[model samples]
Target: MNNNEHLTKRRGMTAEDLLRLRSVRDPHYAPDGTRVVFVEKSIDEENQYRSHLYMWTKDGAVRPWTFGPWRDTKPRFSPNGETIAFLSDRSGRTQLWLLPTDGGEARQLTFFKNGVRDYVWSPDGTFLIALTTLGDDETIEDREEPEKAEVKRADLKPRVVERLYYKSDAAGFLDGKRAVLARIDALSGKIEALTGREEEIGSFAISPNGRTLAFVANRNEDPDTTFTRDIILLDLEKKTEMNLTNGCGTFASLGWSPDGMKLAAIGHDLAYLGATIHRLYVFELERQTKRVLTADWDAHLGDAMVGDTHADAKSPGPIWASDGSGLYVTASERGRVNVYFVSLDGPIAPVVEGDFHLYGFTVHPNGRQAVAAISSPTSIGDLYAVSLADGTKTRLTRANEALENEVVFADAKPFTYQSTDGWEIQGWIMKPPELGEGEKAPLVVEIHGGPHAMYGFTFFHEWQLLASRGYAVLFTNPRGSHGYGQSFVNAVRGDYGGMDYEDIMAGVNAALNRFDFIDKERLGVTGGSYGGFMTNWIVGHTDRFKAAVTQRSISNWLSFSGVSDIGYFFTKWEIGCDVWEDAERLWHHSPLKYVQNIRTPLLILHSERDYRCPIEQAEQLFIALKRLGRETKLVRFPDANHDLSRTGSPALRLERLRHIVGWFDHYLKGPFG
Candidate 1:
């Protein structure tokens, strides 16, 4: 009924109680199914991250294992039960360290200058295979010679060399063939270089017996093509290598089945964003045949996230139901991301349902209980545990409780409206709770990102925070959003701000007509990426919103095509050609086209390091608003990416929230006496 009640916290709030407040991620029961370990993260004074590992007794007692004295993390129990391997940067570099599960001194395993990037303990517990790289070898001459430099009088900026075609938002440019694979011997403290070739290991998985490794990488390949990683299988024992998934370059993944005979992974066929593909492949190594799992364009393969841990969906397969009658898989089917169990061979049916969509899921080791995160626009993901047999769902984590305790959630009512030419548009409306009998609530129209990404049950942490502040929030899936089908998501291809914009405003108008308490005079609008662009587009066309916040948005398509690394490709797919080929089309869809008609006060939130929607986009909009004498402000996060609001640096994510709320407080809810 209440937040504390929902939290299931039995007693007075202790430091442990506060620690429990942060959502726990990747909770796994040990092989014996006795103890549990998870990552507990929090932001400190500087808004920087300080994450520590905590161990839980099966009976409910909890203890901090890896110390937080210098930011310890990711504790994984070795199968043999002798040691727990984890990563800690206490040494000033992120490296692998091992702690004895039975209380012993934690010792350093590898001493590399560049550090161990990410590690996975081999099943046999013999070694921990790490994917890491040091900056390319540089000589004293390679280092800037301050004494011999031409620009010695002025400050020197580091020269960044982009090695490949497209760069990543998190890890920029592909560089000078510097990646290496290392296997740290658990017992000997010796490191063997498994890969020193002129390529970087992208994604990999170990063979069931732990004798072989399968991965995707670009070795001795082109440095110009954006997608260059080739899938290869290497024998750990023999140090021999063989190409597994060929021709399907740039990105590839491999999952070994329980029998070790079959591999299930998706090979890219013109993958956009190096992800978001329409096909999945199951390979029978012996028969040497590949089966296209799903050919439906609407269906997408969620991130593989291959781990040192066994692939749950393949081989050993979704914890057997005791009788081995069926297998469970959380997939996008019919219309939503659902959990379903198909007979080891046949029909599939939904295990969970509603308008919301499912993201991450984990099945209990015992095969009896399962926990998953379900969410929607207004609600962020809430942890829930369900019975594998009966399919009865029980909520676990009360993430929204504290916010809901002091404030009420506007009930998200779903309704459908007509788009311009009679196409039906569906959306949800939220009315602020605790509204006075006669007072009206201001409306906040929220647009979602991924123009192709769907809006469903999964929660949006920001939306709840907004609803808590007494604003009625409106969000809808436009013609280009997901959940309906393939055609719907791709509708905006080669054309954004066209029919999609029309579809979005139609839904907004429908919400206004349906809700009486919504104050049309005090409307506020906000969104990130595609949504932000729409927000900019909305203010350009209508003066309805008193204030607006455009986060990480694109203003001029011409600048976007050149400034954004992926701009060359995204603008290509979105508008059907390169910037030079479609200059007219680019200018036509750009939100800047309507800049002269804009009237509302606007605030732009951007991250300095965001490569997706570059900071320049925000700069463009801010300068435009300032030139027109519009009340506007720009909030910039120092080292965050496009994902800052979701999984950016902890401190930056917090600041992002504060800045958004602060801007609205000053404009939408403000001029406070």
Candidate 2:
């Protein structure tokens, strides 16, 4: 065979191939700094995700640490490095499990009625502190019941909803359960409730001395009314607590100094509502004062970098240097998630910089070495050992080497251009590989959700599927997108369909002008969440695109204000108006108002259980377009939330890809003719 024939033997990536690939995440370094362990997830034959633990060493090889048909995750090494603890559901219910470092049988740990949500190892490694939903089983047993039979009692039941926040996208309907902190004795297996309050803990961290715990919570009577989070320090010995951040704007990701004399966290002033970029702050425990550490950064701290397909993405807080020099943190800047070393004196320097997304990472105790879960447009996630001295990264695990070498993926080129208002915008374009001369591929303009989120350097399976189907994909970080300073992210607020719309159209224009292989006439656009909202708005405002797919989208802001989980506050914060205060203004910005102008063939995709954008949003759009004699269709995914495109069921995710590709090909590629 010739050399050119061997080069052309690679096949395009398909949905099935994407699903079969394993994903690695949550790299945690052992105390001795010799070993690292992370979670590896793969789709089973039943299309269910199965997670197992894998360990990596500096001079040794990467191998599986735990194995089973059931899922095991969240591995953490003990302080002494003699054992490892992780969460497992092998016993029908998720519980904590421990394994010896020298190799031994795994032992089940916590046995909570309601499974544990999160956990932490105490500094002394004598106890395992965890956050679990306080159960009502004891309270239910004491209640009077007319029928003792389970079948009779289950025949008829009316669910009562009292709280304003009764349902969530992640955890279906609320069961009047509150999250509480508890401590489990490592040796005795006795569990004790640590906090008696009913407030939900946002996050927590253990102090170096093991005498204190720093946590964030919303202690207000009606936490839904205001965006407030307060930090509290609990003395393990005295059982007393002190408020550190006393009801400031939303605060989280607490990190304690090595000496236990100070605390660090990332939060905002609530000045810009949801679009506010988080700033790092250091709190002096002795003086009871707090100072801003990265006030001038103008970027959001802690992983805002987005990737569509990921098994597990755990955000790592600031890792303090052992010598008390500074702390290491990952933040989104431009298009990359870079690790930065923040000095105690407030200077910040990058320890690792690249055009890739670091979803999960951990620093060694000595702080000179670290392991990161890195992913790029062309590559799925894999583990890499990074050196703090010279910012050099060494590949640690080849999780998807076969998939990487066999799949012919397109290359994403970064681009910059001026929008309509003289503002600089950043974006990327992926041209289909092996396109012949004098042949132009169809262009697909993909928008990211979080109108506040940027689109770059992240692995997106859906984009790859589209590119493999001979489509030129264009994604951009328009105004109101993060990673371009706080002002740009906040720019979409109060002007959802205005400047943001212009910025998107400007991106489409740039791709058409810069690339001669892009067939502008055969254009397709798709997005989910805020991106979905923009897709709806784009189709209503222009007829340039031939096909459009809007997933979990927003149509009418008036109905969304009352139906969606965050609609009430998000509307007031992002739209700058309430439903009653300014109904006309809300209707004016809604894409439903301009549905008559939508000439493009539209496909509306929504999850039935999505609480964030409610299925009503898509139903309303589909009905309006169909009634107006416009081309439209709706596909509903059952039992899935707003994350259907990313972390939904394996079967449904592949179906979603098929539906999207079918719709776009029917219009843009013209099999209909």
Candidate 3:
């Protein structure tokens, strides 16, 4: 039962092995604390990720609580511990389903026309509140109407955009529908609309007394221009809502105190724009006042690294203690995610500290124990019981035993070196497993997507695949990456390809100097998003690398600012200027402006529906390179968005892996003849 057994005499890892790995996520301890319920995710034969709840105990006994091929997630134990409520798509649409913990047939709770997006049980266990988007029509006929309209392609009408925020990478075209919060009775199955027609709810949480709710929303006249959001307190009985933050700052992760006398949440004042560090705050319900708890903390409060390929990654919000003394929260600091204890009076300390990333965790009622989902470079992911008192983490489930037994995972070795400007940069190198004596392997310098996201010890399937294929993978945290101080993460702003590029190149030189087995002559570079931008920039600026692959990249900032879903605000926020204001500066930073200098063979991967960077980014690069008679190829994934590599179709993910491996092998590894 050793977790590292697969590293012993195991064969190389393959992309197909990714399907066999079972992902463990969303572990919720029953109210009694005797048993735990979690979702075990696996790739089904039909190329879909299927998740079902499994009942687990402290003694290592495990059994399936729900049997289904459909996706079932977010299992929660009722406050009374009598019933388990979860979201499922078993009825063809995702809806809330309730099942008695003692064992019985499950009952469908709600059948809304648009289906439920998210739901949470009231503290009394009497009502279930859910968030969903509704159309202009609010009649019974509209409520029962199916979401999919049967219309021929030729008969489709033109889509008109009347809002500035007309599209999103996750939801596609904005339907002009508002997301409303609705309440459903646990027994009678009666539905009640709690929000007005135009009230658009973002995120919410019910009070411990089930009397009031705290939710986030953008109620400004023009939400597109307004970057700030406020937390609103809604009284269920009185049906009156009051703005709590009063435009103080952007707030989210709402949590009610045990006594329902205070509210705890996390957010920032946009001091650093998109890269601003988040701080925890507490609002006094009785006094109608608020105070910042983690104002001095410099690290990002929640998990924003985003390297995990696991399909069921859950966001662990701030968990309030039973006695209302303090709350537990997850924070990303220096390439690791750790849970911290923060008191209302401004005392903050780490509860669980480690190099590994704790993506999700659930605090028990006792406040000393928690079930956490952890992932590292050597291991995919597993559930563990974390003792908050002594910092002891006990493995609770071995969900990926098949992957561990068959794949020899290459562990990332930490390293640090000063960049060209003497700024210290942290990085990791994953050497190819079992390399022969005196044999140097081809090196692949990897860059992370978010220039703001840090490349840490999280288990990355794509990196493992490349390492297994005899390529030493090198990745580093540059100036813009999180986990560092605010000043460091903000260094890349207004200097897209400036010092950050020098930091990455310096990291590569350090890795090559430290590892003699890395063949510098057969080096390669690749990245997505900001990483992709760096990849394109790297090739256009220098011919040091023999090959490069840019996925879902941004080539021209000027065009991107106009076409990208987030480019309008994102460009102005991250780049420090608008396209109309400083077109010359945008062109100067764009890789497309210097496309004629690219000498390395480039592989461009993009999704057709990618609204983030927009496929036009890739197209612009490919067309420019091809027109110049350069070695470049474009691979477009259909029906996929910006997250193609991580959450796209299983078959498409594997195909992407093959293409990457094939492209690298052709240029850096092999002689097909």
Per-residue lDDT of model 1, residues 416-467, tens digit only: 8899977777777776555566778877888877676655444445665566
**lDDT for model 2:** 0.85
Model 2 Cα lDDT, one tens digit per residue, 494-542: 9999999999899999889999999978999999899899999999999
Model 3 per-residue lDDT tens digits across residues 1-673: 5644434569888988878878888889888888899888888998898889899876789889988688889999998988999999888778889999989988998887777888888998999888877766753124434556678888888887888888999889977777878888999888888885564576799998898878998877778888788898889999999999877788888888888898988888888888888888898978988888887878788887667466348678889888888889999887888899988765688988888888888888777788899999888889888898988998878888767877788899999999998999999999998677799999999999888787887898888889989999999999999988899999999999999999999999999999999998999999999999999999989999998999999999999999988888989888888988989989999999999999999999999999999999999999999999999899999999998888788899898899999999999987720
Q: What is the TM-score of each candidate against the true structure?
A: 0.83, 0.96, 0.97
Scored by Cα lDDT, where does model 3 land?
Answer: 0.87
Count of clashing residue pairs in every prediction: 16, 0, 1
What are the root-mean-square deviations of the candidates from the true structure over C-alphas? Answer: 6.1, 2.7, 2.1
For model 1, the local distance difference test gives 0.66
Which predicted model would earn the best lDDT? 3
Q: Look at candidate 3 and give me any clashing residue pairs.
A: 334-483
